[model samples]
Target: MSEQSVTFRYRMSDRDVFYGGGVVNGARSITLANEAANRLMAKVFQNTGHCIEVRKVRLYEPCFAGDYMEFMARVRKMEGNRAVLEVRSFKIIEVPENPPYPSSIDVLPEPLLSTVVQFVYETY
Candidate 1:
């Protein structure tokens, strides 16, 4: 097990909206999680790793365009050449409703957990 971790922050744009109401697709979280895992695995193993399986995934909240998200990944355990990574996604900021200004945004006092995923990877 390694205590190493990585964080990726992104702001959803109109391009990220997948459906009506600016709702982003749930699959986007998976993609972000994999990215976080890739970065973290490289730091932990000193080599690239390929995701072999997504052991578990849960989407707890909806993400919308204009949402600022944070993705984090940590090395949980390792066996031989296989490593397990835990990834979490959070919504840290959101666009305000009926904003008086175009750039109006609200930062959540407590980050909202949007997704959680467990990924298994094979290190080179």
Candidate 2:
């Protein structure tokens, strides 16, 4: 089968900040990647499969509250009922430092890559 891909987007909320300086927890980014992988699995297999293993989660940059995050998932390979997927998250927009107002936002010239996650899923 040809590879299938999916994308998911979310706006980081203040509640997502678990650490100081409005920084979001790394697990939150992993959760977003998993959600994207789940969507891809459901689209490709017509069922929501279980994630059997997470091969790796590489963090390239930090995510912050008020950042707009984009997650992309693509099938890497498939064998029988198991499939391997790779997910990446990028920051599309961010709250600028020392903004004039609290709600000010800036769109990045290019998406800032935040994380990459690879996992294996199995359909029942």
Candidate 3:
């Protein structure tokens, strides 16, 4: 299979938060990673890839509103039609008072969310 990947940067808006504060739902993080993985399926695997299972999941912290979220994915391993994917999630703390307007997406020393997913597929 061809190696296809993508990186996404997103700011959690009001719609992404429901706690009446800056806190974001965990589902959003998972969605970000899932979306990346799905995109790889179509782009690299030609729509023949499917996620047979989620091997593992880990949330290091809560994502708040105004925080920048970055999603990254790649095909870690492939055997026949099955592939293992590694998806990484990073959350950037937003500082409204920062010099660069609302926030910045500078790479930080850590991440708020990280996940790994397993996929199975058939490719021509």
Best by TM-score: 1
Every model's TM-score: 0.96, 0.95, 0.74
lDDT of 3: 0.69
Least well predicted 10-residue stretch by lDDT in candidate 2:
1-10
Query: Given candidate 3, what's the lDDT at residue 95?
Result: 39
Q: Compare candidates 1 and 2 on lDDT and give the better one.
A: 2
lDDT of 1 by residue, 8-117 (tens): 89998899889999899999888988889988988888876788988999999899999999999998899788998999999999998788899999999999999999
RMSD of each: 0.9, 1.1, 3.5
Clashes of each: 0, 0, 1
Better of 1 and 3 by TM-score: 1
Model-by-model lDDT, in order? 0.92, 0.92, 0.69
Error of 3 at 26 (Å): 0.6
* Candidate 1, superposed: residue stretches over 4 Å from native: none
Q: Tell me which of candidates 2 and 3 scores higher on lDDT.
A: 2
The alpha-carbon lDDT assigned to residue 82 of candidate 3 equals: 76
Cα lDDT tens digits for candidate 3, 5-115: 777787778788867566777878787778888876677767745667787777776777677777888777777767777778777555353447544545556665644
* Better structure of 2 and 3 per TM-score: 2
Model 2: how far residue 48 lies from native, Å: 0.9
Sorted on lDDT, best first, the list reads: 2, 1, 3
